[model samples]
Structures are given as C-alpha cells and as structure tokens.
Target: MSTPLKPLPAWADVALIPLINVAAAFVISGFVVLAIGENPLEAVQILITGALGDLEGIGFTLYYATSFIFTGLAVAICFHAGLFNIGVEGQAYIAGLGAALAALYLGFLPGYSLVFVAIVAAALFGAAFAFIPGYLQAKRDSHIVITTIMFNYIASAIMGYLLVNVLRVPGQMNPETPGFPWNGRVPQFHEVLAKIGVHWPVTPFNLSFLLALLAALAVWLVIWRTRLGYEIRTVGANPTAAIYGGISPARITIVTTLLSGALAGGMAVNVILGEEHRLILEYTAGFGFVGIAVALMGRAHPVGIILAAILFGMLYQGGAELAFEKPKISRDMIVVIQGLVVLFAGALEHMFRKPVATLLARRTTQPPI
Candidate 1:
C-alpha cells in the first residue's frame, strides 16, 4: 500500500488551505457572473467595496458576524468532543424565550445587570434543552444526528405554539413578545460611541460583537489550555484510548453538549437582546444552519471560526448591496454565489489537501545544487 501523505503545517492547515478554497470559490462564482453578462471583475470590486466601503456597511457586516460567531463556537466545541450536534438552531430558538423572559419581566434591574441576567438565562435554557439529546446519546444509544434533527422539529413546534398562543401580545396579532423596555436593551455600538462624543453610524451591530470575540477567546482557552479540553480532544480522537485512560466518554458527551448548547444560546445576545429587542417568530433566520458551514470552513478552531464568520458576514452584507446595485444579479444569484462558497469551503474542503500537501513535501525535500 502507498504511504499516506503527512499533514500540512499547522499554518497551512488552518489558513492557507481555507484561503485557496475561498479563492477557488470566488473564481467559480466569477464564471457564473460572467455567464450572466456581468463584469466579473467589477462584481468582485463591488462585493469588496460594498462590504467595507463605509462605516454602516462595516457595522452591518459585523452585526451579521456576531450571531455567526456564537453558532460557530457552538459547533466547534462539540466537534472537539467528536459530536455532530445539529440542534444549534433549536437550542438558539429556545434560548430566545430565556432572553425574552428576562427582557420582558426583569425591567427593575440596572441595565448592565439585566442584560447579564438575560445572557445567563439564555445559556441555561439552551443547555437544558440540549441535555436530553446528550443524555440519550450517551446513556440510551440514540444517535445524536437523528435525535438533534428531531429536536429541531420539536423546537419549531414548541416555539410556534408559544409564539402564536402564549407569548403574543394582547390583540397585537403578531407572534412575538412585547417590545423590551429601554433598560433591557443591549447597548448598540453607535449609541455607546455617541455617548463618548464619537459619531458612528446607526446600525444593528452592538456590544455582542465584543461578546463574540470574548467567547472565542474563552473557547480557545477551554479547548487548548485546560484539562477538560484535553479530555474532550482525547475522547474525540479515540474513545477506546480515552476509556483505557479512565476518561468517561459519557460524561464528556453530556458536558460537551451542555457547553455547545450554551454557546449556541449566546446568539440571543446578538439577535434578541441586541437587535430585535423582542423575541419574534423565526428569529433564528437560518443563522444556526449557517453555523455548520462556518464551522466546517473554520476547521473548528476559535481563531479560524472568527475569520470564517467575518467572511460569511461579508457575503451577507455585500450580497445585499450587490443585489441592490446590479438588477441583473438578483438575490437568488447572490445566494448561488454563497452556495458556491459553502460548497468549496465546507463540503469539498479537503479536495485539494493531498495535492497541496504533496507539493509542499516535494518543495521541502528539494536539495540545493
């Protein structure tokens, strides 16, 4: 049998490969743009400029990135423990009730304190919701993939019932909670800046972006700098070996799902508390599903997740502007491009790995005359 190729350097594994995938995705997308009678070069320029051209654009980009960062972290943590937790969407959905309950009822506390309560409540709710699947997987031999998939449907039904029958404001005809009071609001970035005499564009971006970054740092510390992280990685890499070493796989599974669901719950800080100021029907808007692509593209690393999240943010914000600027390129086309990026960056992520690794190996081995 032919010997397997060694892994690429860490830097290449993390950054270079992703960059190549993104570039290939863009190239293929360019062909699509050309086929549709648009100048591919101009489209690229427009895409970049639209995402970064102005303060508002930048703000919106980061706003989109914030929830994605939470979801990405959620996915990354469970991947470390070798679990494919697909219920982030549902977990986040349920977490909204926690955020909304705190925002709607806890109006007496100081602004910061109230927001803090909401954050904790959201995480707790999400963790509780995810606990069942984790327990089933660990103790009952239920497949996590199947269970989480079913959980998504269950979450949707539960949320739909609550929104329509229970949480709807009196005679409001909207499937949503009452709007939060000013005290319950998470400070928007522009509002915070204006208080300090710096004028910033009013955008949905808020303090949660900073929270996301902090979450990323915490994930890195937990996964790479702690005993639990080592245990998680060990169990994930080889559960048989982990069992031999006295590590309990069941405990890890339950703990990993708890942490994953908690991270997923953090999305409420960005969507409900930070932006919407209320829990609305379908508030997730597919961000939880997008997290899968972000995690795959990010290689389940915190730093990589952050960068990958930002790239997707660019796609969203830039895609909107592109659709507006070019009538020929509809929102559907933008979605097609997004699909291409996801395809190359996620599902086909490792397509070029062997060739690239082989090329690097040959170059490293070449001797000077």
Candidate 2:
C-alpha cells in the first residue's frame, strides 16, 4: 500500500492552497486567451482596470458580489453538514416569488416594514421549498443530488407557468410582475450616499450589500461559535460518531438544509428588492450555480467566501468590459475563464495537495520519517 501523504499546516490548507489554485486557473486561462491571438497580459490589465478603475465599476462589482455572498454562504452551510445541496437555484427562484408577492400584495404596510416582511417571506419560501428534498434525504435514503437536480427543472417550469398565467401584467408580452411600489425597494446605494452629500455613481448596488456582509458575520458566529455549529461539524465529520455523541444526524441534516435554503433566498432580496425593484423571470441569471464554485473556492469559510465572491464579481464586471473592448473575445469566452476557475477549485482541487505537502514536509526540520 502507498504511504499516506503528510498533512499541511492550517494556513497552507485553508489559504495557501486555494490561492495557488486560483492562480493556476488564471495562468491556464491566459494560455487559452493566447490561443485566440489575444495578448494575455493586456487582457489581465483590462480585467483589473474594468473591475476596479472607477466608482461605477466598484459599485457594479459589489452589486454582483452581494448576490454571490448570499449564495456562497448557503452552499457553505450545506457543505458543513456533509450535504451537497444543488437545489439552491430553485430555492432562490421561489424566493423571488415570495419577495415579489410581499412587495406587491403588502402595499398597505409601512415603507421599509414591508421590505422586512418581504425578506422574511423570501426565507420562508426558500426553506419550504428545500424542505421536500431535505425530508427525502433524511427519511427515505434518497440521494440529494438527484432530487435537487430534478427540483431545478421543476422550479423553472413552475416559475414559467406562474409568470405567464398569473403574474404577468395584462397586455404585456413580457412574463414578469408589475413594478413594485417605490417604498418597497431596499434603498439604493447611490441614492443613500447622495442623501449624505456624497456623489457616488449610479449602479445596481444597494443596501443589500450591507446585509450580505452582516449575513457573513452571522454565518461565522453560527458555524464556529455555537453549540449547534459544533453539532453540525461533528455530524459532517462523521455521522456515526455524531450519533454516538447524542446528536441526531437526521435533525442536523434537516436544520442545516433549511438554513442553507434560507440563505439562498437572501439572494433574491439582493437582486429583486434591492436592484430590479421588480420581479423578472430571468432575475437570478445563474448566480445560484456560481455560488457552488464560490463555496468550493472559499473552502466553505465566510472570509474565503467574501473574497471569492468579490473575485467572481470582478470577473463578471471585467468580463463584460472585455467583451466590449475586444471583438475577438465573446461572452462565451468569459464563461470559459469562470469554468476554468471552477474546474481548478472543485474537481481538481486536490491535484496539487500531495505535491505541496511533500514539499512542505521535506523542508520541515526533522520531518522525514
């Protein structure tokens, strides 16, 4: 039998490895760029400039990051429970319905009060939708991956039916709800800054960015500092051991999945209430799928998630600029870049770990065994 590889230090495992993976992914992406007769260096400069060169760029990057952060945290929560919940896309979709309904039907409530209700309704909707798969996984020994995949199609069909037959405004061809009341919106970032006499450029960013940060802090506290968190980690590490330690794996599975789905719902509040201020069929725009990569790249940690989200936000904003400036590079090429990152970060994540650990082990004093 092959000898087991040496273990890495905590810093190396959590921070160093992920950074190297991202860098490697980028380097590979550069080669892909070169294949298309584009200057990789110029592309890198353009990406950096477009993502952070001005207030407009920064605002748009953060707006994208806000949605990513919510979805990343949702995936992270499920990761810690040893559950790969891929149904967040559907959960977030249903969540938009809840947020839209609250804003549309609850127009009688006070301004931000209705916003709060929409947020709660969003969480409830997401959680309720997720409960079905969670229930099956816990009780019926069903595979979460399969069920969640099926639910994604189900969600899209349901949303299509509802948007066309029920929510679409009369005499309009678009399948979307009427514009929400002005007060129902979460305050826009530029408007809020303008209120304080700071002239910031207009972007899709809004108060929901602050909420995303708060959610990250809350996830950290809940995951690392609480008894429930300990139980979750314990269960994830080894469900058999957790059962022996008086923790019910079934209960943890249900609760963790619920929390995951709720966080997924928060993405809707960021996009629908904070940005669009209207319910659109394509509002989600694949952010749920992006969250999986964010979670993986982040190593299922809040700090990592924030950084990863921002990096993806940069890619999104910068990629748009890239497509605009370079006729040779299409939007589909940008997706290839993102896919490379995901490939390095997920399936091929451990490709370098053994080599890295071997190197580190050789360098350590008195390490050879």
Candidate 3:
C-alpha cells in the first residue's frame, strides 16, 4: 500500500495570484471603457499620457503617490498585525489640525525650528488620536473596527466645528485654518527646474518622494529583519500559538496599531507641510480608504504597497484628465475600475487556494502504474 502524500501549501503560489488579478482588472477596465463608447486604446493612451507624458503630470503622480505611501503603510502595518485600523482618516484629520495650530500658535517660539516643531506636533497628535482606539481595544476588548469607525465620525464633526469656529481664518469664508507661514511651507523646486527646460515632470513631486521611499524601505526592514516584527507576525498568525511562545498578543496589537496610526499621521505632514501648508476640510480626501485597497492589493508587503499606491495615484491623476478631455466619459468610470480591481483581488486569494489544493491533493493521491 502506498502512503498518502500531503498537499503543497497555498501560499507557495501567492506570487502568481496578484499577477493574474492585475491582468484581469486591466481587461475589465478596457471593457468598461468600450461600454462607454470610447476607444479602449485611446483611453489607455490618455491615461498614460496624463500620468507620465510630461514633467507636470509625473510630478502630480508622484505627489499623490507620496501621500498614498504613508497611508498605505499605515494600513499595511495594522493588517499585518491582524488588526483593522479604520481610524487613519480621522487620525490624519486631527493631526492636520494639530499641525495647523502648531504652525499658527507655536510659530512665534524664538529659535524653534519650523520643520522640527511641526513634525513633532503632527506626530504626537496622530499618535494620541490613534492611541485612543488602541487603548479601548486593549483594555475593554472592544472591536477595533467599530471603535475606529465611531472615532472617524467624531473626528470629522469636531474638525468641522473647529474649522468653522475656532480655527477659521479671519476674513475668509472657507472653513479652513489660516495658511502656514513661510517657514512651514515645503520648498518648491519644479519652478526652478522648469526655467532651465528641465521640467521636473510634475508640479507636486518633490523631496517627499524620497521620504516615501525611505518609509517603505524602513517598513520592509522592520517587518522582515527585526525581533519586534517577528513578534508581530507570530501574534498575527496565531494568538494562542504566540501566547504559548511567551509573546503577549495584546501588547503587540497595541504597538502595531499605534505604529499604524503614526504612519497615517505622517501623511498630514506631507500634505500640510509639504504641499498645502494649511488644514483644509478636504485635506485627506479619501486617502485612508484608498490606502485600504493599496494594502490589500500589495498583500501587506511594503514594496508591493508602494507599487500599488503608484498605480492608484496614476489612475487618479489620469482619470481626472480623461474626464476633462473626454466629456462623454465620466471620471466615475475610474472608480468602477478600481472597485473591480479590488473585488477581483479579494476573491483571488480564495479562488487560487481551493483549486491549487484540490489539484495538489489529486496529484498526490493518484495511483502509480
């Protein structure tokens, strides 16, 4: 009698799944473009050209990509630790307020460097806002998803009230805080580059791009090379197993969630400090939700997250242009594409697993001649 062989693990084929999903997404998006009576090839050409055809386009893509990187990393970290941090949006909003206040109130501190104070203030605010949900989850054993969602609503209402009343800039009807001083603004280099015919490829792309790259690298290093990362992974994989191995899953959860919030908070600096230099109502603009998709698409890997972020950023910038150039094609079409991509990607994990397992089982159980 022959012994039964074990099947290969599903994760062994994880690499191919994302690729297949991406290809399918593109095909579906093409169909969508056709359904709207637009030439798929022309639509794709417009997208590529708008995203990367010139220096300005490239800059905008990179600028958006930088913000996505920060938020995406935040989502990725929480996901890796088996926690869902839906509070990134609210945390980022509160952090922006803190940054604006710091710039307005703390701007007069003699000898205090602008960059140092703004960054510290934003990070602290972000950490504090995020820590609330983390504490609740740890102490009360509450569901993070519910707590975070509640916090989002609370933060939005609070921010709206503050922007309209307390933080409102004098003489401006807009519900926004006063713009940051010269010291708080991120330096613009594209103008100088353009004068020399260099045209830096985008208006918004700047040093923040490098900062995002470093952040992604740091996340990868922390998750793959450090002891704390091991604890996080172990805890995520199995709380019971992690507890048996002497790791405190509760502590890991708090730490990971805090780190995730901090990352999201950092995105405010990129926006308020780097580009906008003001706390506007629409400052975050759904980046948090988009980050969730990015995290899922990347499978929680930092490099993959970066790639996914860039792709989404490109789509966002390009889709806007597509709408403008082709009045018949709505920008919402891009949203449909993104939705399809995420839906397929989500299903792919399970779709690939069942078939591969059945095939491996059949292969292992087959009789020999």
Candidate 4:
C-alpha cells in the first residue's frame, strides 16, 4: 500500500521561512549599498536615524506606514485567495476621486454623518471598479494581470480627464478638485498629542495607523476563523479539487477581488481625508504598485503584511531624507532595496521548499518492510 501524503506545514510552523527571506533581503540590500561605494553600516544608521531619530521622524514614519498598511493588505487578500491583482493603482485613484467628489459636494449635510458617507462612497466606487475585471476573469477566463494593468491605464486617463474637466475647481489652475470640507478631513491627532509634549508625525502616520492595525487583526480572524475564508483557501490550493468538493471558484475569485479593491479604496481615507484633504493628480503616487512588493515579502499573512508595510514605510520616509542629506544617494535606491526584498523572498521560497519537503519525506517514510 502507498503511504499517505503528509499535510503541508501551517504558516505559523514555517515562520522561519519568512524570517529567512527578510534576512536575505537585508544582506542583498547591504551588497547594493557597498556596490554604490557607501558604507552599509553608515547607510543603515542613516536609515534608522531618519526613520525614528526624533518625534517628528517617528510621526512621519507612522504616516507613511498608514498608507502601506492599506495597500499591503489589499495585495495580501488577493494573494491569500491565489489571485494576482495588479489593479490597486487604478482602484485607489478612482476611490480617491470618489471620496473627493463626495467630500466637496456632499459635505453640505448638516451633521458629521457626511464623513462616514464619503468613506463608504470611496469604498463602493473602488469595489465597482474592481468588479468589472473580476467579472471578466470569472466569466471569460481572462488573465488577471493583463486585464488589471490595462484597467490601471484606463483609470488614470479617466480620472485625469475628469479632474481637468468635470471635477476641476472653479478658480484653481491646477489639475485637482476642490479641497474637502473640514468635516470630511481626518482630525489631526498630533495637535492633541502635542499639548502633552508629545508630537505625532506630520507624515501619513496618525489615526490611520491604528486603523491599519485593526484591519490586520480583522483580516487574520477572517482568514483563520471563517468558513468563507476556508472556501477561498480551498479554491486557491486546487480549483478542480475545490469544485469537486462543492466550492465555487468563480464566486470566490470575484469576492476576493472585490475585497481586495475595497482595501485599496480604504487607502483614500488617508490621502483625501487625512493628509491632503483633497484629490490631486499625483494622489496615489505609486503606493498601490508598492503593495505588490509588500505582499510578496509578507507572504500574504496579515501580521506579516503589517510588519512588511512598516518596513516599506520606513524606507520611503528615510529614503527621502537620504536623498536630501546625501545627494550622492539617489531616491531610486529605495526602489532597488524594495526590488531586492521581493526577489529574495521569491527565490528563498523555492530554495527552502525542496529541502524542507525532502527532509519531511525522509522523516515520514518507512525505512524497512
């Protein structure tokens, strides 16, 4: 009789795999630093000092982390369901524009209720934008990567035209909509913290950081505790097997895509509601694209995504400073670092998987008949 196959390791049990990937990324980053003739230790110190050197720096780090949290989680959700979503950029753009329009025109409501409405509208628009691609994929078997990338271009052009024509403020020469009303903005928590002699970061970090933490927790619960999540995972693991077992892969795919888009939409709360309090041409600034790298490095785990998000946030905040302080180091160095992290993580998975399976098989096999 053939021996039964052992189950694959739980994510928690294989925790070292991600750790190894992160460690390898750092080593690779160090090499890049050396190749550029910079002392890796000094570069690291600068990065750390710039990210957390002072209260202001810490505040900035948190600000950046907030956006990272949203996009990273967006990417993570689809990845968990074995879907590759590359449309976060477009989704974010549309969502931000939607929020901006709501805040500008809908803020006339008598109470603070408009704030919640704006957020919901943004999320809904993002979901709708994503649903189109999801439906096409489910119905026609279209490749998600190609469709999503095309959607990104379509979103950018559409948003651009709207901003230049329909959404343009009466007097503003710039390609942007009117600033959001006071009620629509995320309150400045830093000012309150300052009264106690504690300064919050002026960057994207703020109440959104807490929101990101809560989102991560919620995602973890959904994935590990819910029947829907089980179905998603089942389909991800093997669609034919899941179909035979009564799970609907198409439904799961569409649901997963919608959820991913909603997360991307939530990112606008930080941009249009928190920081800029308005929608601008460069509002997304590529955070959506960065989410892909974050998700890959995190391996699509909620907690892992949070940690990876913070790391990317730090790189973004610190890299800006590095460019300003040491003009010799290009801001593009951050991109290089991020790319290396993704590469190391992807490569490490293959490196470890074969060895791990071989060892496990040896351990489980019967030695003698």
Candidate 5:
C-alpha cells in the first residue's frame, strides 16, 4: 500500500526545499567544473566578486534583474490564472516598437512627460500583441501554450521587418532607430547618485529599477488584496465552481493575460530608455524565457520572484566576469550552469518532495512518552 503523505510545512514547502534544491544544483555544477580542470570553490569566489565586488558589477546585476522582475511577474500572474504565457518574449519585443514611436515623436516633450507617454504606449502595444492568442484560447479552445510559442516567432519576424525596413537609422548599418532625444532619455541611476554626491561607476542601472520594484508591489496588491484577483484565483482553482458562482472564465482569462502582457512590456523601458536609449533588435536576449525559471524558482510570488531574479542576475553578470577572467571557462559553460539551476528548481522539483513528506509524516506520528 502507498504511504499516506502529509502536506509539507510552509517553511519546508517554500523555503527549505528550494534552498536545498539550489544547493544540490550548485554541488553538481561544482563537479562539472572540477571535471573541466577548474576549482569550483575558486570559481564561486570569482562569481561573487564579479557580481558584487564593485558598484559597476552591482549596477549591471541590478539592471538585468530589473528586466527579469518584469518578465517574472508577468509569467507569475499568468501562471496563477492557470495559464502559461510563453509569448512574454515576443510581447516584450513588440512593445519596444511602441516605446520607440513615442520617443521619436514626443522627443519635443519634457523628460517626465515623454517617459510617461512611452510607458503607456509600451503597455498598450504589448497587451494588444498578446490579445489575439489569448482570445483564440478563450473563445476557440486553442491551446495557449502552442499559440503563445508560435507568437514568439511571429513577433521576432515582425520586429526584424520593422527594424530593418522602417526604423533603421539613416546612413547607419545597424538596424536600430536614431537615438532618443536628451529629454527622452531615462536618467541612469549612477547619474542620480552622483547628483547626491554619491559617486559610483557608470552603468546602465536606471530609474526603471525603481519602476520594477513598484511593479512587484503592484502585483502583490492585485493578487492578494483585490476582488478581481479573487476571481482569477477562483477560476484557476476550480473553473466549474467559478462558473457556478457567476464568474466568467473567458473574461478573466483575457483580462489576466492582457495584464500579464502589459507587465512584460514594461521591461522594454529598462532596456531601450535606461540602457540602449533607442530601439534595437533582439534587445530582450531571451530574458523572456528566463522569466519562466524565475517564476518557478520563486514559487510564483512577487517576493520570491525578486529574490530569484537577483540570483539569476548575479549568475549572468558573474558568468560574464568569470569568462573574462578565466578564458578556459567558455560562455557556454555558464549557460550550462544556469540550465542546471532551472532544471533542478523547476523540472525536478519533486525529486525530494516524497522523501521530505515521508520524514515529516514519521515525525508527526511519533508516539509520545
């Protein structure tokens, strides 16, 4: 007979298990590093130093984390509603077009005004791009996963055309738009710091990082403190029961996905306004997909997502530093490490679940003296 397992404690389910899994992943990764003729302990030190040793490294790490925060929250919201938004990558990409248009046309406006309008444009465009797939799923019963995955390729092609044919800078070989006006640029965080007499190394970290924090706060409020959130969660928990209670699953699905897409679109602001200062092809650089891992590792919670995003961000910046410092460790090796992290944190999450549950069950059933 199968053992009747008790649910894990909150601490174990949320904190302890994830920590153990991450540690296990790193342990395995250390073995791989050793096999490659490198000292895993030294490599770990290099990663920490590279990502957190200086302001410049911290800046880049935070910059990347900002994007991951947007995308992670996007995916988390959709996941909560029983949807898998694989098209966040594409939504973010297409949203850049809207942001670029606002920058180009409203360059005459003051800095704050231009930024505000661009934010609205990006969110609208991203939501609109995601709506078709969402609609197909809700109305026609199309599988959301397949539709969203296909949409990613469509978004890529559309972006390629727009960049090369329409938005290309005059007399420039690169398929990027002309730079945004001075007033249109989002001020970098280092510049703000310098103004306050807190000098730091120049980096792409910008005001958008604050925006990401705000987004996370907003997501928490919406998910835990609002009526619409209740409906979305209800539908996810039990669709037929939600219908019996007069909630429309179709409407909730569409609205939830649109909100998710808009959140994902906000990521473009960090890249285009904060860093690149103009629209560029493939600026997202697969961060959309990485958001999936972030959301999974974070347990689909905003706080967890932020922590996971930072960890991945450290991996990214630190990996670059490691590659530069030790040429023997190729960039591909860093990707392998990241992949292993995702694999353990997500796909193999239940590997220790039964064992932990069994141990807890035994403890709970122990005979008292």
Candidate 6:
C-alpha cells in the first residue's frame, strides 16, 4: 500500500527539492569520508572552515563563484527557452581567443576602454560559435544536442591549432599567448577593497564578481519584465500555440542560444582579465560543464543559480583544502563527492519526487478541525 502524492508548493518545489537532494548527497559522501578513517562531522567542519574561515579563503571561494555564476546563468537562460545548450565549455574556450586578440591589438587604449572592447569581442565570438548550431536547429530541423556537442570538439580543435601555430608567443614553448600589457589588466579585489580603506587578504577575486551580480540582475529583468522574454517563454511552453499566436519558435531559439553563448563567453572576464591577464590553453577548466549541475540544482532561476553557484564554489575551494589537510583524501575523492551531487541533483532528480509528493498529498488531504 502506497500513499498518494501531491504537487508541492512553488517554494517547496524550488527550495526544498534541491535542498533534500543535496542533503542526501552529503549523507552518502559522509560514508566515504568515514571509510577513509576520517570523521565525517570533522570533515564537514574542515570544509566549511577551509572555504570561509578567513578573508583569503572567502576571496578564493568567491573567485571560483564568479565563473560559476556566469556559466550557471548561461545554462539557466537556455533551459528557460526549452533548449539544452552543452557547448558553453567550447564557447568559453573560443571566446578566450577573441579576448586575447583584443588585449593584444588594443593594448594602446586606456584600460577602461580596452576592457569594454575586450568584453564585446568575447561576447561576439561566443555568440558566433553558438550561432551555427542554433541556426541548424532552427532552420534545418537538426538536433541541438548533437550539433552543440559536436561544436565543442570543433572549437577545441580550432583553439589548439591557433594556440600552437598562430598565437604562440615566440620563444615560449608552452601553447599560450604572451601576457597582456599591465595597462589592460583589471584591478584585483584587494586593490579595490583598499580604495575604500578596507583591508583584505590577497586573493584572485576581482571586479568581475561584481559584473556577475549585474549580469544576474539584467537576466532577471530580461526574463520577467520584457515583452521579448514573454514571447520566448510562450514559444518554449508550446511551440504550435506560439506559432498560432505569431511567435516564431525558430527565431526565439536562435536568439536565446546566442544570448546563452554570450553569457558563457563573458566568463573570460574573470579568467583572462582578472586572474591570468593572458590567454592560455584550457582556461575554462570545466567551469562550463559544472554549470549544468549548477543550473539543475538552481531550478533554472537567476536567484537560485547564484545560490547554487556559491555552493559549488564552496565545494571546489573546500575540496582543495581537504586534499591538502588530509593526505588520505585525494582530489579524486572530492570529485566523487561532486559527482554524487550532480547525480542526485540532475540525473536522478526524481528519486525523491514521489516520496515528497506523497507527503504533500497527505498534508493537503487531512481534515481541518
């Protein structure tokens, strides 16, 4: 005999489900910690402290969070449009080329002006990378998933070729471009904090984190307050009905995907402009792939995505600390934990759905006395 399930409230659907999923993942991860002769509770404390114990840790956590925020928003936007865009990794990779090109050629401009041009270049290149797959899906009835995945490989290959042949710095064996001029370098977080008479630890965090916040606000406004957003949602909800209502699904798909790619490209601001100050091979470092997990855990909302990105940043920074503090726990162990999180939050999301629904159904059906 099974209890019937009911739909959860909006708040529960958005907040509770993901929380439950994350809790379950952590519980399972606890066992792995215990198996390695470490106390799970102690491990949890270490993770929290290592990620947020001091200004330095906090800065690094936020540094990682900035990238996740950009990629998460990119994924969330595409999800809203009923599109599965998996090319963010490749898009960011390709966008780095454009950013590097801008830095190389526009070094003569003032720092602020050069930064603006570099940002536009990255967005344009990323959008152009995604445009072909989007066009194919919209006009040629091609599967977006396949085309986007293939594009990732193509982008990677192109990047490799350019790095090795065209952009490789002379006398530098590594496959990378020369460092951008100091004038083009973005200010670091500590420098900004100093301006306000606030002492802060040295870390890789920078102004790009603030840009991520602005992007989130912009996304919220675009998705909820604009006419174009309404048309996008309409087409995503029901394509045939949208067509009847004079909304073109194909056009919306292409536009949404281009927007998604541009957002992903903007991640280079944190990497190229803020931290590296140069273009390097594989600079994206899997942030784009992790974004899918962030979007899933966030339920594809901008606010939710920001929270989820912070959580992932904690995982990344804390996981590194764990590896250092306890030699018994290797980096691969942290990866396992991350994998479990994504597994429960995304691939196995329904594991708790029926049970939650049943509980909600019971609550709603009880007699009011």
- C-alpha lDDT values of all predictions: 0.92, 0.92, 0.80, 0.80, 0.91, 0.88
- What 10-residue stretch in candidate 3 is worst by lDDT? 5-14
Model 3 reaches what TM-score against the true structure?
A: 0.89
Residue-wise lDDT of candidate 1 within 138-239, one digit each (tens)? 999899989998998899999999999998998898899999888777899999999999998999999989999999999999999999999999999999
- Per-residue C-alpha lDDT of model 6 across residues 139-198, encoded as one tens digit per residue: 999988899899889988998899899999888899998988876666798998899999
**Regions of model 4 farther than 4 Å from truth:** 1-15, 194-198, 352-369
Residue 163 accuracy (lDDT) in model 3: 90
Candidate 2 per-residue C-alpha lDDT over 1-369 given as tens digits, one digit per residue, 9 for 90 to 100: 976766899899889899889999999999999999999999989888899999999999999999999999999998998999899899999999999999999999986799999999999999888888888999998988899889988989999999999999999999999999987888988899998899999899999888899999999999899999999999999999999999999899889889988999999999999988888886789999999999999999999999999999999999999989987888999999999999999999998898899888768756557
Candidate 3 CA-lDDT value: 0.80
Question: Model 5, range 1-369, lDDT digits (tens) per residue?
Answer: 986788899879888778878888899989999999999999999998999999999999999999999999999999888899999999999888888899899877865799888888888988998898889989999988999999999999999998999999878899999998876777898899889999979999999888999999999999899999899889888999999999998999999889988998878989987889899989999999999999999898898899989999999999999999888788999999999989999999889888888888888899998
Poorest stretch of ten by lDDT in candidate 2: 360-369
lDDT value for model 5: 0.91
Query: What does the lDDT read for residue 317 in candidate 4?
Result: 78
What are the models' TM-scores?
0.97, 0.96, 0.89, 0.89, 0.96, 0.95
- What CA RMSD would candidate 2 show? 2.2
Counted clashes in each candidate structure: 0, 0, 5, 4, 0, 2
Model 2 per-residue lDDT at 75:
91
Q: Which ranges of candidate 6 are over 4 A from the true structure?
A: 1-6, 360-369
Which stretches of candidate 5 lie above 4 Å from their native place? 1-3, 359-369
Off by over 4 Å in 3: 1-15, 109-112, 189-202, 352-369
Candidate 4 lDDT tens digits, 276-342: 8878886898999888877877778887787778888788878877777766678888778777777
Model 2 alpha-carbon miss at residue 222, Å: 1.3
- Candidate 5: the clashing residue pairs are none
Candidate 1, lDDT over the whole model: 0.92
